[model samples]
Target: MSAQLIYDLVPLGSTLVYTDGSPRPPERHRKKLAVWETRNSGGRLIRKQAEARVGNTVLPASITLHKGDYGNQGTIVLRVHQTFSVNSDLKFAVKERPAIGSVLVLARPGDDAELVHLAANRADAEEWLTRHGYPRAVFREITADTVAADAVEGRAAA
Candidate 1:
């Protein structure tokens, strides 16, 4: 699937994988394997930024994926995020979608809201909110209606 399709159809917090259609290189070829991993890895959808005009330049619409987090013990030091423009050439596939009844913890309420976390239930969401400070976070529950709509629209996860 195309990146645009992902931005339009796949809900935030869904797991997605993008690949260059190449076989994985052997571990012995460290450099080549590292490069291959960059082009072929899975991540959770986090943000979708719409196209915007800033002075003389027009920014393209893009989707951001949370690739990984680096930390020690319970402290997170670095977060790896990959943003792909809708025109990206890499092949993308929706690996998994947030299940119905799950709650999406958005950064805020708006078209530009980013998914901060996906909780299994409202109770879990509240527990997470207490630990993570997102004063403006909004909770959105995944429903069967939404899933049905996606299917009706031919946006089934591959």
Candidate 2:
């Protein structure tokens, strides 16, 4: 089985309102960011994008997904930082069965980047990814392979 993740919603950062359009001038910066999640008719997670309330500020695009079924309904939380430049710094990394059971969490500084990650087994991998500010694209690619390998291992262990 491949590595899969179910992520819980986590607030990225704070948003401040700015009246001026100066990216350099911190005074003109607005903290409010646009947060939205895209899902299909089946309620499956699609993608998440966050943009600043003022100016053309856009946060780093990332994917936060939950692999488990939610009472027969599926949902995932998507969020972006309050600043645009901050989005560009997003990245992703994954390691399977770290010290036993599956878990995902952001392995970086700053609690805002930290997210709780749970696999099919309610692992912490998803959480780790959120804390690290990883891009959604990388999450999909790496998790897919990791989960696949995990399945084989799990079956053998069972």
Candidate 3:
């Protein structure tokens, strides 16, 4: 379904939720995380910077939200990579979703080991949602060039 790509952020640890409506945990228990993204004018999803899911109990849990048009359908979403310390249940309420593009799912659900679902290619993405049990996932094409640019910029700054 080239409708919308949902790069849902799946932050690991119980700190994602606190005693109140806090989106982040206290600084002592919090780890730095970032969700960098970019897309073409056609609304194709692109990965600007996605950190590796490393370290003990570290999870890159944030989505790069975007929007796009898919034939007669339209969607809004982003690219997401996540890792969990252990099997845990979580909740996320995105005020918005992707318009349509690439859904490069870079994380694995610790609880559901069989739920590794993500797609490339526009047509394949449409089928991905139907077959892989993904909701509103629309994958577009993202080449290494997209990320190469990011590296160059980083090097130049350094």
Candidate 4:
């Protein structure tokens, strides 16, 4: 029941240049570049870091975007890395049958349900549901066959 980690890359700004010796577009100067990380709890994602990166060349602590301004065009790419952890253990009673290699989701009463764990076997799934206080009726299981079919579909779509 550990949390999941998510990574995202964002674009902050770009280095600009002027053509025909014109400064019509005011130059926007920035000191340092940064990235932030957040956690998702109860369907709410919160920002946990204010300044994740700064300009650093030797220590390799910050990230820099380098792009050339050609024809009054400038482009820069910023990479943002994030990690999140969620506790997925709950205690409840089991009322449904379990299957191997099935994905299980725990549904809470007024809150969004979350993926708690993957079941290796019927016993394991049943035990997890019973211990996590999740009723079998509130739990949804995606069987291994279905997962394989979904993977095939995903590959085709891609």
Off by over 4 Å in 4: 1-100, 108-113, 148-158
Candidate 2, 15-86: lDDT as tens digits:
112122222324334333211111111112222333234567544434333323323243334433222232
Model 1 agreement with the true structure over 15-127: per-residue lDDT tens digits: 99999899999999999999999999989999999999999999899999999899999899999999999989899998888899999999999999998889999999999
lDDT comparing candidate 2 with the true structure? 0.29
Ranking by TM-score, best first? Answer: 1, 4, 3, 2
**Candidate 1's error at 101, in angstroms?**
0.4
Reference-based TM-score, model 1: 0.93
TM-score of 2: 0.17
Better of 3 and 4 by TM-score: 4
Q: Cα RMSD to native, each candidate?
A: 1.5, 17.2, 18.2, 21.2
lDDT of 4 by residue, 77-153 (tens): 44233223222221111112234345344444323333344456556767777766556324444554532342232
Between the candidate structures 1 and 4, which one is better when assessed by TM-score?
1
Estimate every model's Cα lDDT from 0 to 1.
0.90, 0.29, 0.30, 0.29
